[model samples]
Target: MDDLVRIHDILQHATPESLVILNEIFTSTTLADAIDLGGKILGRITAMGLVCVCVTFVDELASLNQATVSMVSTVDENDPAKRTFKVIRKPADGLAYAMVLARKYRLTHDQLKERIIP
Candidate 1:
C-alpha cells in the first residue's frame, strides 16, 4: 500500500510532461483495503495535476478528483446479475449494492408504496 502512495509522490515531483498508467492496482485485494489504497494514490495524483489512468474497482475514486471521470462496466438493466462488459462514462454514486438489493427484493419506490405508511 505504501508503494502506491510512494508512486504518487514520485509522479508529483516528476516533470509535468510525464504520463502514468496504473492498471488494476487494487486487484486481488479486499474491498476495504482496495478503497484505502486507491484513495491515497488518487489523492496525490489529483493534487499533482498529473495525467494518469488508474484502473480500479473502488468506485469512490471516480468522485475523488474533478479531473477524474468515471467509466463503469455496466450490467444489464433487465437482469442486474448480467454484465454487459461495455464501459461507459458515468458518475459512481456508490449505491450499486443498494440498487442490487432493491432489484432482488422488489424494494423499489413503487413496490414499497403500499407497505410504507405516511
Candidate 2:
C-alpha cells in the first residue's frame, strides 16, 4: 500500500500548481487536515532553511482570468540565500486582501488568492 502511494506521490509532484498537488493528495482530508498538512510541509521546508512564501492573487478562481499581482520581498536580491518576490497572477481585489491578511498574520506569502471586492 505504501509503495503504491509513494510512487503516485513522486509523479504528482511534477504538477505545476502546488495547490493541485495538495488537493489531489488531500482529497479525503478536511480543511483542518489540509492546514495541518500544509503546516507540517512548510515546517519541514523551513527547518531545511528554505523560505516558503505564499504569493496570492485577487482570487484562486480569478487567476484563471489572467489577473496579475504586484508584490514585494524582504530580502535583497543581491543576497543569493534569501527569497525573492516574483509576481503572481490573481485578481486585484484578491491581491489586496492577501496583502491585508498577510499583515494581520505578520506573515508574508503563506498563501495567495483573490477576494470579493464588495
lDDT of 1 by residue, 1-118 (tens): 5556667577757677768777777666788877787787777777777788777657877777678888777888887766688988988755455667686788888778867855
Writing each residue's lDDT as its tens digit, candidate 2 over 6-118 gives 53564445343333222223335665664454444434433444333433221332222112222333333464334445543323352234454465555654333323222
In candidate 1, which residue ranges exceed 4 Å CA deviation?
Answer: 1-13, 74-86, 93-118
What TM-score, computed on C-alpha atoms, does each candidate reach?
0.56, 0.27
Q: Tally clashes: model 1.
A: 0
- Residue 92's lDDT within candidate 1 is 70
Model 2, residue 105: C-alpha shift (Å): 37
Residue 25, candidate 2: Cα error in Å is: 4.0
| Model 1, CA-based lDDT | 0.73
Candidate 1, after superposition: displacement of residue 75 in Å? Answer: 6.3
lDDT of candidates 1 onward, in order: 0.73, 0.38
* Candidate 1 Cα deviation (angstroms), residue 44: 0.5
TM-score (C-alpha) between model 1 and the true structure: 0.56
The prediction achieving the highest lDDT against the true structure is 1
